[model samples]
Target: MKGKVLSLGAAALLAGGALLLTGTANQSNAQDLLGVSFIDNVKPYLEFRPRYEYVDQEKTGKKDANALTIRTKIGVNIGTVLGVQGLSATLEAIDVSALIDQYDPQRTKYETVKDPANTRITQAYLAYKYSNFVFIAGRKYVAIDDHRFIGTVNWRQMPQSLGVVAVAGKPIQGLDFLLAGVYERKGIVDSLNKDWKMDKMPIVLDVNYQVVPQALRLKGFAYLLTDIHNTYGIKASGKIGLGNGVTVSYLGEYAKQTDPYQKDNVATKPDIDTDYYRLKVGASAMGFFGNVMYTYFGNAGGKDAGFSTPLATLHKFDGWADVMLSGAAKGFYYGMKEWCISAGYKNPVIGKLMIAYLKFDSDKDPGFGKSIGSEVDLLYAKKLTKRLSFLAKAAYYNADNGYCISECNNKEDALGKNDVTKYWLQLDYKY
Candidate 1:
């Protein structure tokens, strides 16, 4: 988790042909472009997203952050390469421009807004298919399941990607598997400090089987992050139909983390062992859906260790306000427990609207109070056209009376001690 950041932004290349390729290249013409036999299919895509974000933190004394940013992504997907039937390639570039940069991209004077002004090659990958297996290499988005353990942080203006060599396959009718070795991870921080390189490439393995087509599915995964920790887990999820247009869904997952394979002979190596659990139940009918969930992250026996998902999309879990994000990375002294309730409605004309409430507590009592915090989040998204969309989101966090501060054994727990509120309005256009 601690390593040099790969600076891919140094040589920012803008592919001007992306615009032209998206418009005029048909199959007949693409097949014989520039005397090449197998440019068989060329599809170019572009996305422009302009967003405004406001953040207000009560205890942080610094000025509130107002970040207005725009994200542009342009890419081309080549279905066939050099007349090879199963060979394909994808190239993408992303740029984030800030109009109002009043937040901390790299520990600035203002509050923290993860959006930074920079450009990088977001995705560049080559894939080849043979039989039931597909081999992938280069840099691209690497996500597993729900993105809880390993994922692309797609919520931010600058998403996360991995430099990896991977193989994926569906060898049977109801089974799927992926094995990847990740050498570099590009996070959503500033481009200069975004990519993380480790002494050894992390290994990820995932296997899933549909026990019953749409009724039950089982999954097993192991993630070995060098110098961090190895996490292995099992998950079972399923959906059931009760009546006409009504369905219920459920999920249960459990994981354990242990010390990873380490070779950086430091004075003192890390000691980590923890447990994690997540349980959820949900139901949906007639354009309405609701869910109740419980999640637990073990403390790794407190002090300087804990279970954390270094490669996860942290923003999607814990709380929308990120009240538990930083602290969760180091593991709390008393561990952390979260209870969440969410409801949403979707309509073709009215779009989709959702609201979520989350409560955080400690697994064990500290001298102060077990109460951690609570958060409320609201979101509305609508598609304006075939290739355009609008989204609005807000989160409010109210801190509790757990003031152990610097004098406490676990200062990292104070990451959520300050009350914070944030709002975002965004527009996305894609072609």
Candidate 2:
């Protein structure tokens, strides 16, 4: 596999130069012979990304997906450790390569650039902290809240990790808390399906407070995915500052889904009731920003099931032309609903700009028809220095005709009248 990822990137650059020369030659008796504080509390991490992606679809002559990819990540982090004062440790690795794979990482059929080159071990953890607690176990990267249900999809090119055990705490003032336990997951195509992992023993809970710190916040969550589903949620976010330089922001959310231990599966007969909602409002000043959003999933638990997240980060929610990322399906009925409007601007000499508009529909009523399409997204970013960066992106969808009667029934005359386009270009570097 590419020479075992170049021999683990030459053993992580020789273990970061032997932890920076053993912490600068034992900066003084190596903490009384390694009781910890080794190698000056090590830290070394790097990242590189190169991407080019393009895809066009409307079915018909089928053949449009161009990809060129590269992603690499390496890591190290160690703190206190051995002497164990709130110990810590971390290790990371990731590699995805393809210099032109012409798209299809739907895991198999060899080359369709779903960015699948592979080399894993995304993160290894061990953590501990006192005074307001913290603890973690192995395998890492997890996101809650904004990730929508759980995340770490890191925008693809291999980013999904889990095998958790976690904890977090904050005993007072502006509360905060978290708890987690997961068995395994490791998908972003688990480098081409090792059955795409997933072993389930899920459990998660999160809580947040911060009443007015950043201008208000509140949150709550629950996951629990053992015999399949369970999701719970609440959220409220805020920001407000209105005076010449305007600022206003808001977010609202709610969630519900059921069927966990109350299980019943005749091998895939799922119907985990549902409900989900989201709302957003925004404003910013000088460097401009704007937003309007709405989302709803709900399917009242009919056609098999509907509200789902399957580990979010679903291409940052609905419109990236990922076609509702599992929401608007029409075989066993799925649900989808969305609306978005965004605008942005940031300029340090003309650097960032963004625009978004999306719309999609269908939330039960699957006898086909609920206009499911409309999208337009664009972005540009720049920062070419101090760690390098540049990016350009695009997406266009446009499907409607009720998205070919809810997604091409019987191939809808050979793939429902096309209309989906995408493009991306990127470069990033970090250390």
Candidate 3:
């Protein structure tokens, strides 16, 4: 797999170089030597990232994971093709290779780490833009409304992309709108599950309105995953200046989920009737910032099935430990709730430093206990050069006694009698 990835990377580099040379050679003539128009706008980009991750869990006999991996992406964008205005195309390829395969990708027998070795076309799309509207078709990344319900999942090596037709525009002043119909979703586990082929139309709609410029914003969305579930939500967020160097920001969101078409067919699956809400407030001054947030996933009449964000960029929401990425309502009879507090500092000399603490609890009694666990996260990031950066991060999760018996459903669950710790060091370069 390593050799294959290296070979592909080399081939892509050569191809990109040839394209650059061809474009340069065609500058003399209005048309290229191959009879292609020289007017086409071309932009090429490359990215390389190498990361080392270590995971330690409490489960006995469960080996710890230490993984070293690299991710490479090469792509090009072509604009104004065929002398047509508002027409463009993009093609990109991605490769993730393992340097030391000490972790399980769910497809292997080692300890799980989620990141896998794979190669695939991450993005290929055609787009047209006219006036204030843009239309896109093909496979691409999608994210909506803070990514609480939908996102590209870019934190992972593979990320996630969707096959869809999408449209976006500012139809009116202070208002922006987006709509998409997804036919398939290629997830981070594409190499393991292939793409999730939707049997029905999965439609998404998002709208945002600037009520008071930068001081206030209102947003709404509706995501319908046919034959699966539908989500409708609204959000309000804003920032206010408080004289001096201090500023205050607040966000509130509410969403409801319901069963999709053919609700009766899947009798074994719990009915989809739940609600999700989040509230956040923050203050920033000088180089310091602090925030407090609370999130709730309402129980559906005490059923184990709670609010689920099947399409969300889970890692970003729940703690960085990724314990609740699958939805906090998993094992408990009631839903799940979380509270988080975070603070950060930034300076030219030290880059940026951040720390966060999170507490998890069950919304209702589950016989054993209501407290689930707590996690602490720390991160440091520095930009070494124009196209290079370094990052070091860590997460420590301490489980309550009840966490292991209830929330720990899989062998990979970090929740156990003892604490779980994970560390990562990464370097990134983009051009």
Which residue pairs collide in model 3, if any? 104-111
Ranking by TM-score: 1, 3, 2
Worst 10 residues of 2 by lDDT: 191-200
The sequence of per-residue lDDT tens digits that candidate 1 reaches over residues 35-90 is 55445476777788999999999877788998998887777787887678899888
Worst lDDT 10-window in candidate 3: 402-411
* Residues 1-431, model 3: lDDT tens digits: 65766766664544344446655554546454535553367788889999998888776456788899888888778776656788887778888888888888733545578788888787878899999999999888888767778888888888888888889999899999999988777888864223334455578999999999779999999988755577899999999999999999999999988766433234443457778899999999998999999999876553335677777788887688877665542422356788999999988778999999999886865556667788999999999999999999999988874333233333344343356799999999999
- Sorted by lDDT, highest first, which candidate order results? 1, 3, 2
Q: Pick out the ten consecutive residues of candidate 1 with the lowest summed lDDT.
A: 1-10
Report the lDDT tens digits of candidate 2 across residue range 1-431.
47766866765654344446554454446656765455336787788898998887764465787788888888878775656778777878888888787777633433234567888877878889988888898888898767877889798878988878788889898998888877677878753222112344577888999988778899888887665578888888988898999999999989887776433223552556777888999998999998999988776444356667777887887777576665532211345678899898998778999889988776655455666668899999999888988989898988864432122343252222358788889898998
lDDT of 2 at 69: 85
Candidate 1, overall lDDT? 0.80
lDDT of 2 at 398: 83
Q: How far off is residue 366 in model 3, in Å? A: 1.7
